[model samples]
Target: MFIKGVKILFVVLLFYLMTSTSTTPLEAYEETSPARRLHKAHALCTLNKSPPATDDNDNEQIVETFIRCMATKMGLWTDKDGYNAKQVAKFFNKHNYENEVMTIVDYCNHQHQQTNLDLWAYESYRCATEGRIGAWLEEYYMLSLKL
Candidate 1:
């Protein structure tokens, strides 16, 4: 009975945490100190350096690589770039349509009080590889600003 009660309590707590709408992403991020964020980023960067499994799409690997690249470019961490930030930036600039990348970068910077560097970097890579970054950025900008 005690074990069952504990399991039930755990499930309830998990549900509450998942369903709680009171905390925004920005607020949740702000609740952690900058040092903590840096530590987490460092750990993630280190852990994600290995290649993913053969069957996986490696989306998370891509995100992690982009995060590390952003950290390097921002001087938040000193690590070698397997994924080059300058090369990504050049690609983005070369392929961007009608300054949409500039607009998105500027808007994200204003919203984040920083460049939203990681997200922009990820989006740039996604755009280059997958196309339709402009539409995705527009939707993301609208939703994020609305929040």
Candidate 2:
């Protein structure tokens, strides 16, 4: 009887923790102190080492690679062309920001389709970073107040 009661209590506590909006201080710290966003850009672009190919497609490909790398780092992308729903949900859950942000990606693919590759790449990075930072800042501020 005691063992069963203990198991039930554990389940209840786990559910509460998973469903709670409040994040621990360590989680806030990890979210606020984001890793360098452009680490992949320099290694992939290597513009100083050699000029990129003259073809527009080649230049665009470089931009695509950079954008993809950034998205992957943010857990918004997968090895395949698009994002995996399960993985994205897991990311948002782990980060504890499902209630704060709306769209899965900050910018939609259709809106940038007509733009120049450079602009598209910049917008992608900008939007993702802004959304993440905004959420992190809010969570960090709230947690700090609690502390």
- Over 34-125, each residue of candidate 2 has an lDDT whose tens digit, in order, gives 22222332333333333565865565454455545544555555453343334444444657665444354423333443335444543443
RMSD of 2: 18.0
> What is the Cα-based lDDT of residue 110 in candidate 1?
40
lDDT of 1 by residue, 1-147 (tens): 344334333432332333243244434555445423434444455454556535323534444354545355334333322233343233245355436544444343344332444444443333332234434434433543455
Model 2 ranges with Cα > 4 A deviation:
1-32, 37-51, 80-101, 104-147
Alpha-carbon TM-score of each model against the true structure: 0.26, 0.32
lDDT of each: 0.40, 0.42
**Candidate number of the best lDDT:** 2
Clashes of each: 0, 0
Q: Distance from true position, residue 88, model 1, in Å?
A: 6.6
Best by TM-score: 2
How far out, in Å, is residue 95 in model 2? Answer: 16
Model 1 alpha-carbon miss at residue 140, Å: 20
